[model samples]
Target: MTRDEFMGRLRRGLVGLPTRTAAEIAADYGQHFDDGAADGRTEAEVAEALGDPDRLARELRAEAGARRWDQEQNPAAAAGAIFGLIGLGAIDILILLPIVFPVFGAVIAMLMTGVGVFIAGGFALVVGPFFGGPGGVLAAILFGIGLMGLGLFMIGLMALLTKWLIDATVWYARLHYRVLKPALEPSNNRSQD
Candidate 1:
């Protein structure tokens, strides 16, 4: 597609953005086109350099949604951003989704097992007298208490693991923004040589 087509797609994708923010993005890309032309590049070459418009649109929309969510405290906007990106389509799906889901499943399974163990331990402690004499009952109760403690610890660890997963995903999103930020800038405006 040409620069005009790119801009049109970008504008539509950025509809959720504030008018000024959307216009600024369009202007930056338009400037990118003009600067390329001045440097003797063809429109097609510049558009090609800009990358696929449809995918670009999705990226821009997701980025805009993330920014809005951050600035305005909008949960719906945050959810929209996540859905729009869907692992950013940056990571290899075959590598990412399969690994991520199973890890997630394992964490959840661990959490469930922890809860189950804790419950069973409580039951055993309550029925300690059914085992044998007082010594046996005391031994059974102590074992149950140990199991309950271990289970609670495991559950807490799983909770931390779940939080870490989300934190890691957001880190990827931030990294994507960092990479794209420079690509969108005019060559002359870039910080690197």
Candidate 2:
């Protein structure tokens, strides 16, 4: 494909992205073509080296999502990042959806369970003294403290796990992109020769 055709397809593929972002991406790819030309390559060779514009757009979207999630760490950004990664491969969706959903569900359940335990502990701490004699009140206070500690620990652990999950997903997506990228480069070299 010529540079104009390649950029047109890329711009179409980047439709949902913010205008500035899409323009920046287009300019970046345009630079790639310029660089290739300086190295005595044709627009078609550069386009081929870059791979399919639609696939490139998808990968760029995934990278952008990952970057946004890293910056914001919000649910919306996380969802965008996850869906972008999943969109990269049908095989990934087929293999990962079942496992990912259950793991996330377990994390959420654990967090809720932790909160419930903490609340129960607070209730016990407050009401136990009212209901019981001296030794019983002391035992209830101890139990409440123990329960609260356990709940806090569970919450902290879950937070760490959630962070790790996001990091792993980003890593996997980047790894997938890197693995495919070199396959295109050799063709560019062969075309040059």
Candidate 3:
């Protein structure tokens, strides 16, 4: 079947599911059908490869039902978990804005640095010979070197912080999946049994 047709069938099969859960299952089943078709399978073969829709639908319904019951029993915990996740994602994106858009960050940094260097150079060029001959030039040289070093240091520090934040977010997502997947499965098949 075409992708849309397959999705329609899957969506109908999962009619009782929560909207988010139904959409996820439909999308997953659609991808499965697409993969099968990519291997030169006919529509019937792809549908068969996805297996009996009724059985899949039942399993999904059971899982969702069990999860809902679990959430109901621990409403506060569920709310905290869900909102905690949303908050974390929001925080990560806010922090990553400048990091991922480094061009903008770099441009701003460059503009500031250019203005700083120009002002320092202009001062040094105008005042160097009066202070202590070559000693004045040395002082200006030292000051310029220090300003560039400080700028580089700030850039490097920001890069490291961004990398760490991104890595932490990835780790957090993987940890959440690992914990939640098994939690969603009924213990000892109690619900189905």
Candidate 4:
């Protein structure tokens, strides 16, 4: 593809983006073509190196959404990021959805279990001395303490796991882009033919 064709396709694909944002992206890509020319590469070579304009636009949108979510940490931004990532391909629906849903369920269950245990511990601590003799009272206190500690540990572990899951999703998306980029390049298709 020529530089004009590549730019036109990219601009069309970026229709929903803010005008200034789209213009900046276009300028950046235009600079890429200029740099390629300086290195004695043709417009077609530069366009091929950039890969499909539509795919590139999708990636840029996803990346921008992710960045917005990271910065704002709001539900709308997060939803946008998620939808953007989902638009990248079928792997998310076919593979990630199955695994992520179960993992999310497990995390929620852990949280519930932690809260239940903590409440049970509080109940034991409060009612222990009323139930029996001194020995029983001491035993109750110890057991209550243990239960509360266990509950706190579970809650903390769940938090860590949640963070890890988020980090892994972001990492996997970036890895997917890197791994698929070469395959998407037009030069790769010509070489295969």
Best by TM-score: 2
Q: Residue-wise lDDT of candidate 3 within 32-148, one digit each (tens)?
A: 877877898877777755655654565566445435534553434333333333333455556655654675466556656755665665565556546775556677666656656
Of 2 and 3, the candidate ranking higher by TM-score: 2
What would the per-residue lDDT of candidate 2 be over residues 65-146, giving only the tens digit for each residue?
A: 8898899887788888887777676575687779878998999899889888888888878887778856798888987888
lDDT of candidate 4 over 1-193, digit per residue (tens): 9999999999987887669989999999999999999999999999988888988988888787778767875557666666777777556468788888899799979988988898888888788768885678888888788888888888888867866676577667767877886765557667678
Local distance difference test scores for all models: 0.75, 0.84, 0.58, 0.81
How large is the C-alpha RMSD of every model relative to the true structure? 7.2, 3.5, 14.6, 5.3
Q: Name the top lDDT candidate.
A: 2
TM-score of 3: 0.38
TM-score of each: 0.53, 0.74, 0.38, 0.61
| Model 3 stretches with alpha carbons more than 4 Å out | 1-135, 184-188
Q: Quantify how close model 2 is to the true structure by its C-alpha RMSD in Å.
A: 3.5
- For candidate 4, the 10 contiguous residues with the lowest summed lDDT are 73-82
Order the candidates by lDDT, highest first — what do you get? Answer: 2, 4, 1, 3
lDDT by residue (92-143, candidate 1, tens digit) is 4456777778998999999999999888888777886587856787888897
